[model samples]
Target: MPYTPRKAYVVGVGMTKFDKPRGERDYPELGLEASVKALIDAGLTYDQVETAAVGYCYGDSTCGQRALYQLGMTGIPIVNVNNNCSTGSSAFAFAANAIQSGQAECALALGFEKMAAGSLGSAWDDRAQPMEGTMTQLFEIEGDKEYEVDDFGPFAARIFGAAGQEYCEKYGATWDHIAAISAKNHKHSVKNPYAQFRISPSSADVAKARKITREVTLPMCSPTSDGGAAAIVCSEEFVKAHKLEDRAIELAGLGIATDSVKLYEDKSRIELAGADMSRRAAQKAYQQAGITAKDVQVIELHDCFAPNELVTYPALGLCAEGEAHKIVENGDNTYGGKWVVNPSGGLESKGHPLGATGIGMIAYMALQLRNEAGDLQVKDVKHALTHNIGLGGSCVVTVLKKAPFYKEGSHCKDRFGYDFAREERRMTQEELDKVRSKHFSDYLPPSVPESKL
Candidate 1:
């Protein structure tokens, strides 16, 4: 008999607002805030979590333990993950697997990043770089392009910029189409309170933004950000024990893929951009879910660069090869079209805090599936897909759907006292004080005016 994985569901999800680097909060604070919100959303205490996987890229070893310690040191097994940009989703995959394998009934998947200002670069200078192979592949593909590797804004820009140039040459895509993608995502961000860039820009504005490369513009790339996100994953049995049916969003399918032979073997810049890896992972996820791209109503894909978004359209089967630009030109990639791609503003506008991005995507999808996305909600959403990738590189694609027993408006109204269709407000100081007094007496009281107290 074939092995059947146990079912897992995301009972709760939460995230900090993505912010520019060197923000007020550090990694520990960011992680704890997101974790606490997730726990509250699930109506559970941290003690219920049997295991945890924390993702980060710019931290010391065991950063997971340091961040999670804020939740109380319950001696649960904690796994630290760093798979570049895909770290968060990779951690989530591990957490879900723990439930599916019966190793844990409830698990926490959390990710946070505290990055420095400016474009991303290597942390260690005196070591064999992990991206050595990828760099070699890129140079081979761009042998005489007159592009200086170091002069490019970031290595990522050159990689995706080359891919975009390749795509246009092969598929007749124009630079305008790429700018349109950036513009669309920025427009979507205007409605997302949690996004980093809430101000929408016109396609012309995006196209005219400072160029990162010959083909990539400043607005077309994701900013380096600092933030955190978290999810509560539980087995079906755990969900039932907690009566979480109404709130649970089933993790219908998950697939993770790494660099394939094509990354090094193929001369195609599109392949070098990890499109093949994304394609394979998405195919596996669709297969596992017993669904296809046509079944998906909404998506939150990695738009670290606008060009990658276009390349990924075909990779995820959202469109045919060389036709991704048509989807953008026809307004088929946004609301009132075939699919609402990156309705959360995506990394392009939502911000990519590396570790936080994958789980952030999950949080956004959970909100959409639960009809709690407020102004960013997609209509009649049945199934949602998430694609998160990190160059070096790894990709994770996941499918989510409403739990079979889920009832519309049952969870949010009864538990959270909020209308799912409207914007969720931050908890007032009184509410926070109440929670702190009741469950966290050791915590220092909020510094407030004596009169207010």
Candidate 2:
């Protein structure tokens, strides 16, 4: 039997304010907040969602269910996912595949993380480490180079900084050129209400910041934070049935690429860090969407580190080969440029909550496509792109735009009794009541803001 593909649309999207990990809230509260808000924004109820894919990296198995149980034990399938930093997009891709494959009419994709403060490190010590191969290869490359191999810091900074160093060594882009990309994202973060760091920094500020590595500085890296984000993905058929014509944003094309042999061929550090995976993913997504880089007006790129963003410009075909620094120099990566990249401030400023970052990217991109992003909105955007990646390694590139039936006055103006896009608000009890299942739970968290209120 042949399986015909159907269109998947992100009809609703929501997220919690990406905040420093203060331990004030748990994963359950964060996940539920984003889920309830998403359901309400879609004008749908929990019972209506046929299945779900939830992502969290710092939790035990079924932690997803623990969070979802508050919505009611609907007995719907909830597949838990963990894919390093790309966890949220992995969940999103799961839901999109579910809809497109006709396995479910509607599904939920949710991601949240309650991370430890400071630099991220591995939790498991007994098992064979997943990143061992990449780490070993990174050290080997450094051993052969003229640079000091012992001026190290966090594992993430070292590997990514190596890639940035390579870009400069190979293409004549200086460290300041790499820093400029970080500075640009910091500037963009000011308009994002959900960003963790709203303060802007100049390129010099980035260049001179406390060095994490020779090629990386403090401000150039994403922070460990606590947050959650979610989206409701459904088929076009379901949209018509639910009278959601005015708001649905089509997931026109989606491509997921995993590690190829290039990841460890003793080759470029850029490929070792999986930038080539992003390139391949973008290629597949663009082919599916029937569009080129020229057609995309806005982007929510996975700038996990400043160097990655610069490498990604060429990977995603945003600029000529090794000319990513040119994108920064020409002012083409921000508003009024050729493409407004990382208008959500990107992972660098927006705060990377492991599992939540990818989904947060989707939520922000949805706001832009709906024209409800307010201060951060890109003008006349038709196509928006989101790129999320994880090391050891996978990358998901998604292309989205307004649905054919989309109109100017979307339900966002009144959905959830306010603009879910422009106004960042937690779900009130009244609002939660509108989306939760008729069959419910009394699992109370005394620490949640809404619950405390």
Candidate 3:
């Protein structure tokens, strides 16, 4: 018999301020604090959590053991998940499944990282072998930035550079666009209390800052940071039975997909893969919750880089292919747009702490749904979505709605006033090709023959 999916509700969410990464804070300590706060917010006790899912990347096997030890949370199954940047949502999805399957009434999801004191390069190259030149020279080729370098380090830097150029060329967007994203996030962080960089930057100040390199800039990127975030998930019945305050968000849907690890090796465009994964996830989630993309009033996206958001808009069905840049250029993404994206200030402003990023997205969106977002709140938020991407490019999309769909007489509807849960809008190969072209560009080495995948 097919098992019925459980109706999961977000009962609590919490995170520490995302600031410069500090070694002094241990993983277990940060996780404990976040978990305790989430528990308090959910109106539940630690004893009520029958299971817990912890997400962390770069942390060794014992990291989960160390963190869970802080809360003396033992005996129950505590699964540790590490999916690069999407680790937190991966764990949250697992916990949601557990609650929906009637396995546990209440479960916890915690994400933590101290990457500044820790090593990010370790994730790519454990050896940390320095190139035969200075870090500066190593990043440049004949005084120009190099894009052909494929190993993770230089490759990431070059990708950001290319994206910066692409946005400027295609959309007439400037560094100010990226800065606007960071500035908004910082302002949102101010009220978050748990955000690391709560200091807002003026439009003029952000636009005038010097670039870190040709591609990367101070405001366009997140500083290495240390932080932890946690959440409590439970069944909708569990909340109603307890008569908990109606301050909960329902997990309408969850979806995940993996793209080719060798982006250069794959024939499919990276952007298409991401967008398809998100669309599939949204389809499933919407079908389960009975909502549609038009119904999502708020979004918290993975803005690890500004281009990520620019490209994501079209990929996520927000706009047509090759039109995301144009839409962004017209200020369609600011405070009063058709929909608001990344009100949490994104990774650029909120600071990306690897394991904690996905949870941080959820933490911010939950507040938005509960009308606790303060100045960043959407006027009348009914549905919201959170999207996250991981290493080499894995993607996850989770959707949330204001009310529990299964509640008696609580009709869930999308913008069309039909059920939100439904199949996705299918596309022909031509359409897919167009979207792919927008995401993956042909690499032209001025002097060398282009390497075709």
Judging by TM-score against the true structure, name the best candidate: 2
Off by over 4 Å in 2: 1-3, 439-450
User: Among these predicted structures, which one has the highest lDDT?
Assistant: 2
Model 3 Cα lDDT, one tens digit per residue, 1-453:
997777788877767666686576666656665665566556566657778888888678857656655444345688999887788888888888899899999888888886755225644555653322223332342234354433333334445545555556666667666666656666655655545576788756666665554555556565667888888898877888866546568887787776533333322223322445555555666677677777888888877766567667766777876677565567667577777877777787777888888887887787777776655678888888888876445677888876654232222222113321121111122221222212222431121111210
Error of 1 at 270 (Å): 0.6
lDDT of 1 at 219: 93
Worst 10 residues of 2 by lDDT: 444-453
Between which residue pairs do clashes occur in model 2? none
Candidate 1 total steric clashes: 0
**Whole-model Cα lDDT of every candidate shown, in order:** 0.86, 0.88, 0.65
- Residues 73-127, candidate 2, lDDT per residue (tens digit)? 8889999999999999999999899999899999999999999999988898899
Q: Is candidate 2 or candidate 3 better by TM-score?
A: 2
Ranking of all candidate structures by their TM-score, best first = 2, 1, 3
Instruction: State the lDDT of candidate 1 residue by residue for 270-340, as single tens digits.
Output: 99889998999999999989999999999999989999999999999988999999999899899999999
lDDT of 1: 0.86
Candidate 1, superposed: residue stretches over 4 Å from native: 146-151, 409-453
- Cα misplacement distance, residue 332 of candidate 3 (Å): 2.5
